[model samples]
Target chain A: MFKAIITVKLRPSILDPEGKAIEHALQSLDYTALSCVRIGKRIELQVDLDDRAAAEAAVDEACRKLLANTVMEDYTFELQKA
Target chain B: MSKVKFGVVVFPGSNCDHDAYHAVKHVLGSQAEFLWHKEGDIGGADVIILPGGFSYGDYLRCGAISRFSPIMKEVVSHAQRGGHVIGICNGFQILSESGLLPGALLRNQSLNFVCRHVHLRVENATTAFTNQYASGQVIEIPVAHGEGNFYTDLDTLAEIEDNGLVAFRYAERDGTITDEANPNGSLNNIAGIINREGNVLGMMPHPERVVEQLLGSDDGIGVFASLINAISGDVTIPGVAVLP
Candidate 1:
């Protein structure tokens, strides 16, 4: 078995509306030191695969098929043997 | 009468519901109704649209809070049964958040709310939504949003292309959708995509804004026309005709 941890995030250039709203809220609260903020998702998966290569392939398939949308989100994974 | 009924979902912060409703009723001359977010049902419409806007004040992420609305549950069930669903801008974000569509809408690469007229290359004409457009045809549409950046892994990107799920791509004046013309730095210059069933489409551009000549261009008429035609059995997938 193997465990896969996936980190998904938006590209760097796109506007982060949630982040901006939070920044605005922080400013309203008199918190002026913070400059920027971005939000992302993290997912973990456990698959009964034998090899690292197979586990990686499964993670990739899951991300493409449903976990991550290629158009708006980027995802990377780290695999470890169980 | 085409007998196709369209419904536009109106969430608390949805700003483009009226525009989309008019696009369907006036431009397509069909029966279109407004659906509130709190409603339990979608009124059994043929096509359900999630209009653009800052739904739920874009809190907890663009569409995060809106995803849990009473209406979204029905929308998800409807979509699973192969109902036609289209999400534009913030609607697209809601779709992602509700898991009706894969992937997430992130901050734009430029870190600004981009509002401009952009050229898009039709990548897949086989879907119900893109049947009116010719594969590879370039059309101009207006986009206004902040978190429109599209992201996915390289393998998934390739899969989307291979499966013909990519509906439209951002392009330049030369009709080439390349990295340079990519406004939000989306992977593969993708501007729109369809779900695996090919029944749901999510795009950032506002087709409703370009449907009338008074809006500076009627390029978006074909898109709306295509959807109407799809229901009326006037058009078919994989047809051989170039779109302007």
Candidate 2:
């Protein structure tokens, strides 16, 4: 078995309205030190693959298929034997 | 001959209804009107459009709340019957949320509100909305949104491509289609897509903004024109002649 960690984020050019709203809310609350805040999703998967290559392939396929949207986000995964 | 009546859905916060209306009316010279979000029927309109803007204040996610609105119920039914539906920006989010389209629009990776013009390639011009453009044609349109990331499963992505549902792709800085030019990081640089029936279209860019030459380039007019041609039974674009 192997474990995989997947991180997904939007591309730099696309706007993040949720983050802006949070920034405004923070300023209204007088938390001025917060310069920036970006939000993303992290997913971890455990698979029963025997080989590292197979595990990596599964992770990549997962990211490409659902975990990440190539249009607005990028995903990177790290695998470790369980 | 009866004029093709088009209706643009107006949600509470929709700021692009007028833009969409004008694009259909002034640019395509079609009869277009605005339909309130609460309206149950789309007035037998041949084409229905969901314009961009923050709906329900982006509550419960960008389009999650709007998906349940009364107008959407009708829109869903209409689209299921093979009526043409075009969702732009926030409309795209709403379509995905309503399950009329695949994938979801998540927050941008940078957590910024990106607003700019982007070049896109006409990857599949065979849909009712994209029939006026040539395959591989590059056009520029304005993009302004926070959550425009498109996501789907691997098999679904391959299936969409294999079925020729991918309508548009991002163009690189060199004006060529490539993965690197993908602005939103969408899978396969997918900028737009249509339903299996070739009637529904969802895209992030505002083609309405580019329909008039006075606004800049008129590349977007072709999208509007394509629909006009589709309903008129005069679609003649060689690239869009066959379903991919």
Off by over 4 Å in 2: A1-82, B173-175, B234-244
Which candidate should be chosen as best, given DockQ against the real structure?
1
Predicted model with the maximum TM-score: 1
Q: Count clashing residue pairs in model 1.
A: 16
- Per-residue CA lDDT of candidate 1, range B1-244, in tens? 4467899999999999998988788766778999988999999798999999999888747887788789989999989998899999999888877777767666787778999999999888878888778888888999999888776656777788889888989999768767878888777888899988988999999988987777777777666667877778653222223253
> What tens digits encode model 1's per-residue C-alpha lDDT throughout A29-82?
989997687777888879898988878888899787566655556788898777
* lDDT (CA) per prediction: 0.82, 0.80
- TM-scores for all predictions: 0.74, 0.72
Off by over 4 Å in 1: A1-82, B234-244
Model 2 whole-model lDDT (C-alpha atoms) = 0.80
DockQ of each: 0.18, 0.08
